[model samples]
Target: MVLALGGLAVLALWGLDAVRIQPNRIVSGTGHGLIEALGTGPALLVMLPLALVMALAWRPTRGREALMLMLVTAMLAAMPWALSLFIGQFIDDPGGAARAAVSGASWLVGFALILMLIDLRQRLQPGALVTLVLIAVSLGSLGVAFGRGALDSLALVQEYEVRRAAFAEAIVNHLILVGVAVGASLVLALGLALWMRRVAGVRQGVLGVLSFIQTIPSLALFGLLLAPLAWLASRFPLLSDLGIQGIGWAPALLALVGYSLLPMTRNTFIALDGVDPDVIEAARGMGLAPLQVFFQVRLPLALPLLIEGIRITTVQAIGLAAVAALIGAGGLGTFIFQGLGQAAMNLVMLGALPIVLMAMLVDALLKALADAARRGDADDRTG
Candidate 1:
């Protein structure tokens, strides 16, 4: 996997278009390969890590896998600089409207490097701390790139400059929407799961309803809630004053929570119910109170799976929150839809790239937490 992905990165950097000089944002510009973008000496210099990666992949060792991880992560870190170098040297952007778009090859190189990082990390099975430091290095490098205005000539960065305030607002809104939805659904799912456990008759019906909700398309769900919410807001002016209108966050929040319920409830139910009776009995045998056994023993045992449900719900909410923009809910998706409407690809990237990064970040963080929980559980079992 390392060899294949590294080779692809090398091929893309050397063979495909690395940059384009757009006279303006709308018109297509002529493509230039890495050699043309950064010249012979620098372009060849950039390929060295990829070559090392290919060589290292030829011989597998614990040390070599770890080395490959650093190299791949360095490659990711250097990506911003690679573009910045080309932009700083090759493009003369006095007015800044002349866009130096990161064309096909550079983008592919970044993608390939990320894949190599993912592949290498899986092979190495590095601890969470190591993984997080590498991620920080990559992200920090990008932050530096932006802070220094190294990406100023780049089209996407330019778009961000135009809507910096909106971009910030979008990110905050997007996270808040996802966070609120996931949190609310978690509380609701927990209650429902407990109720279902106590009242067996409701299990099938509750699950069935949640399953049905899952089948409805997100857009349709949004539409379905629109009228009822609008009516309530009209009937009760208090609801209207509180911003519970049809075509805003109220409906979007409802739709997101609705879509989230099944996974959350199912996982919560499974986690609590799947606790070993023997373990619970052991706690009881220790002269612990029933509440203590349930809270201290069963809950701890069930935590990893409960966390798994949260991971699922949070990731799903991040993506769906983008769609909430359609109802004037205001998120990164607003830029996406507007960019599509205006035929501005850079503007779309402004909205999309952050979202993709956010999803990956949340997924990785939650997965790490779940893994830690599982490890703690295993240690307890053996000890």
Candidate 2:
């Protein structure tokens, strides 16, 4: 109710401009509010019914689901039309060329609508939510495609258009950096964690070192790796040929691995150590050797938490990879830095939004894996 009311208030009191229009790529200009952009008739037509549905959703009733679905459907239906109307206005403008960029108000409304739909999905079955999401994605894709011309007019889209190849390459480079760093960190951390479980003295030392590394800021860590990497590259032409430059991927990757080690190691250590001693004893009594007990019992029991560590590490690395762009290791952060340099907010969002979405998507996937593993563990115990 509170959220719905807040959204309603925003829609009513705040300017609801979906996107800004600029005369050219270089200029930043004002956008039209929802009412202004779409005209009072269309804007009110959507807003009034949306507000009503939201308010009614607060009460428990048989029709609540229906109402929620109706609201979502309405928003989805209106999206393309709203975008078309906004774009159509600029078509006849005296300006020879104009750019259309998403506005803050538009973002606010879109976020509000998405949040409401997500909340509503909580009441739905998993299959239903999945269907809803697929439908939404399909419609949203169509809407964006229909409005592609308007989108291209946006400064951010223009930036993407100009550097499409770089953008694609950046995504690949970012994924490679994250994948290698997280994968390496997980392998090393698991080994350290398993060793630490058996040796108390080494546990503290290893953990302390990793914790200290985590305390070092990411930029400082990147800076710290520069000298040794530079020396290695200088001493070995082979290393240089393999792209082990001081300022590019090598230091960035090393820094990401360093940052990832703490969470990966800590979670793994805790998960392994926390395994039930009674369970281990039972496994041993079943004639299992020490290796079998450790691998078949301890590791399986700890798998979920280990996966959780991977999840945390992967999400963290994705965000940090953006910063890697600063050192010539290109990723979405290239667009971000370029946007900042050009004072283009939309361009910054172009880079930042993908990073955010990637993190969210990865987190969701790993979370599902962890949940499944946990459920399997529970079923095993019950059986």
Candidate 3:
């Protein structure tokens, strides 16, 4: 599998268009293969690490995963610079309307390397230190290249340069929407889950309603929310002054939290309910009070699944919050919708790239937490 991915990267790099040099931003521009973009010497240099990785895959060693990691990390770190090199060599007017956009070959090759990295890490199950190092190396190298203006001539970077402030604001708003939604949903779901437990009659009804909410299309849900919010704002002067309008964050947040509840409630209820009754009996055998047994015995065992639910809900919310931009809830998706309206692909990427990174980050962190919790549970059982 690893070797196949490496071959795909090689084919993409050697045969396909590495960049598109647009006369202006809107045009897709002319294709330039790897050799045309970076010259034969540098092109061969780019393949050298790939070759080394293929060789390592055939032989296999414990330490070689680390070496292969370094190779792929170098390839990814060099990706932005690779585009920078393309611009330096191919663009005739660097300071004018001319800009270079990354094309199919660049994206495919980069994605292939990222897949390779993920595959290696999953197989090795490296410790947190290794994981942190991976992040620092990947993001640090890319961030340095971007910060130094190495990619200034690239269309994506050019778009970012134009919207630097708005980009920052969008990122903050995106996170805020997801954060508040997850937090609110967590509290509500916990209450609902506990209530359903105490009142057995409502179990099916509660689950059914939550499932029904999930079935609603996001855009349709947003539309449905518009009127009630507008009525509320009209009925209450304070709500109107506070930005609780028909088409802004008021409806967006309500919709987000509504969508977030099912997973949170279901997982939380199952986690708590699934605890071994035998263990609870044993805790009572120790003469502990009911509340003490619940806290000291049940909650700890349930924590991993609780985190698993949060992880799922948070990742799901991140994507939904992007859609919130449609309702004037400003976020990274603002750039996406704007770019689509204006036919500016690079601008769309400016919004999309950050959102993808944010989702990946949340998924990884929460997954790590769940793993650690599971390991601790194992330790408790053994000790």
Output the number of the lDDT-best candidate: 3
Candidate 2 overall lDDT versus native: 0.79
RMSD of 3: 2.3
TM-scores, all candidates, are 0.91, 0.89, 0.91
The sequence of per-residue lDDT tens digits that candidate 3 reaches over residues 207-239 is 999999999999999999999999999999999
Residue-by-residue lDDT tens digits, candidate 1, 1-383:
88888888888888898888787888878888878766889888879878988898999799998888888888889889877877666578635678888888888988898888888888878887998899899989999988988788888888888888989999999988999999999999999999998999999999999999999988888888999999999999999999999999999999999999999999999999999899888899999998898789988999999999999999888888888888888999999999998888888888888899899889988998999999999999899
Off by over 4 Å in 1: 36-48, 59-67, 127-129, 285-289, 378-383
What is the model-wide C-alpha lDDT for candidate 1? 0.89
Task: In candidate 2, list every pair of residues with a backbone clash.
Answer: 16-34
Q: Sorted by lDDT, highest first, which candidate order results? A: 3, 1, 2
* C-alpha lDDT values of all predictions: 0.89, 0.79, 0.90
2 or 3, greater by TM-score: 3
Per-model RMSD to reference: 2.4, 2.9, 2.3
lDDT of candidate 2 over 1-383, digit per residue (tens): 52464466466424656677887766887777777655778767657756666567667465776566556656655665566566667756422467677777666766666666666666654474676564667467545655656344555666677777988888888899999999999999989997997788898899899999999988788888888999999999999999998989999998999999999999999999899999999999999999999899999999999999999999999998998888888888888998899887777887898899899989988998999999999999999
Question: What ranking of all candidate models by TM-score puts the best one first?
Answer: 3, 1, 2
- What is the Cα-based lDDT of residue 215 in candidate 3? 97
| Greater-lDDT candidate between 2 and 3 | 3
